[model samples]
Target: MENRSDEFSQKLLNEMNALYSLLLLFFYLITQIIAIYVNFCLVVMVFRTIKDEYKYPYYPLLFLIMFSNVLFVAMTTAIAVLGGLSRIVPALAKSFPVLIMIAISYPTVICVLDFLLCIHRFSVMFWDSEFWSIHVRWKGPLIFLITLPFVVLISSISITYSSLLVGVEIDAFGVGNLPLYCFISDIALKSLLGFLTFVGYVLILLRVAQQNRKVGKFTDFTVIEQAFPIACFQLISSILTVFMHMGVHRSAWSFAKVCLLKYAFTQLLCIVVPISIIIGNQNRRKKFRYFCVCLKPNQVEPANHRVCITMSNNRTSTTETSF
Candidate 1:
């Protein structure tokens, strides 16, 4: 009986492993596809539509965000692909400094950019004239430019230090990792930031609620609502990251497995902003309607979406407005 049980358990485990492997490979391919198609479309559309944001106070921040999303997809896909080839080709793996820089530096910049993005929304939503108008002139863009290098600098040091602690094991990480301790720390830093940003969003939402009660003040939820999608995801991702990392490491998941999980969630992160922004912009959404005739040209985005993009918890669009 004992021997039979052991055999059954082994067989089950093997079957599960095989399934996981197939799924992971599928995910990797999807990541590449998303990187090329989605990011490419986003890049072109954003630059083409650059002039549209001229009057919008939060436009520069969106530009930074769109640029980061483009970088996020492209850089992550490159890292995932090259990181795999590197493992097979030891010479390429030795290119750690460059790989490490791109891997850690970029997303860390993104996390900061996201937080700044949150901060930007908060300012505009709450302080339309006092803080926002002032910031909009030169302060917002200037601050983003000034702070970017420092964020990257901090990220490089963290990656380098962590690598020193656990050796440069840069194996296919789109948004996440090293040895157990090192990996935990990496996730911890991002999650902590995500948490803070999430809290910031909630606060902004509460403030918006308050503002709704008041009159005479010009308060639209446009910027705040646009940001809510990311803010919500950041909080969710932070928790998910910690959970997924623990599971992957304890099971001794392969580099590809790790990358797949990261890629899946991170790709969603890359997608949400562009989708939300585009949907909010009447012109861009019109452009989408033009391209995707499957969608009703008269079909409207989610209501309250000039300020928020809400959908059913389990909704899949046959149209472009799904996001």
Candidate 2:
């Protein structure tokens, strides 16, 4: 009877693991597509704006954030796909530690980038001259250097603690049980960074909005307003991550679902932010549309002859008459 009960328990666990692996595979593919698309669009948009001579010094920081997301998705998808396969074939399980390290570093890098972006935005709104003077460009590299040691220290401590809690489980057959290192500690750190980012964004937006209100000008405030969607996206993603950590202690399947939902929402944010900006700003949208139209072979015009001569002739005649 005891042997039969053990068999039943093993069967149930295997079934749950299979379901969880399938869900991870699905989310991995979806996030990879979304991350690539969004990163490409963001790069195009950033370059286009730069070409147009809109020198918001904080722009590069935003690019870094998008770049970090791209890296995050790439690392996560690789791990999910490989880890899922490893479940079926123990031979591929050796890479599990590297996968965990990638997973831990991906979000850590993103959180650091997000915090840097917040600081950049705050400086732009509140200390424009000083930001541009010497600190603007150096800030990103500085933050990276400062955060590296802390990340290493905290990650080391977390891994050690986690391993102690759930010792390294290895089967006689060479397949090892993966350690849940950095999961909880990383979430705690990210939640704190997310909160700071949210507050910084809110304060910057409020300041920008107030300035616009006083001057009765709205154009500059558009960017601030558009940023609200991204802010909300970050907030929601952070909350979901916290919930996922909580769920993991209860049931691994529940935790996997939460992770899937988190990535889905992140992809939604990636696609929605750029679309929102293009839709909300009519002038920029029109300019982009016109640019696209001009890309067609038949639509191209010689630069010297593109402008009608009539307007120039009229202006010349007016000058002659004045003389």
Task: Write down the TM-score for model 2.
Answer: 0.61
Whole-model alpha-carbon lDDT for candidate 2: 0.54
lDDT of 1 by residue, 1-323 (tens): 44543443344345347777677558657655755665666666776677866567667776777788887676756665676775554443344235445655554556666676677676666566655554664566777789777666555555433333322333333233324444555667678778887788888778877767775455565665666677677668668756754554323233234444554666566767666666655666555543341134233465644433333323534443333
lDDT of each: 0.59, 0.54
Clashing pairs in 2: none
What would the per-residue lDDT of candidate 2 be over residues 164-197, giving only the tens digit for each residue?
Answer: 3323222322223223344456667767877887
Query: Least lDDT summed over 10 consecutive residues: which range in candidate 1?
Result: 160-169
Model 2: which ten-residue window has the lowest total lDDT?
Answer: 313-322
Q: Model 1 Cα displacement at 67 (Å)?
A: 0.8
Residue 68 lDDT in candidate 2: 58
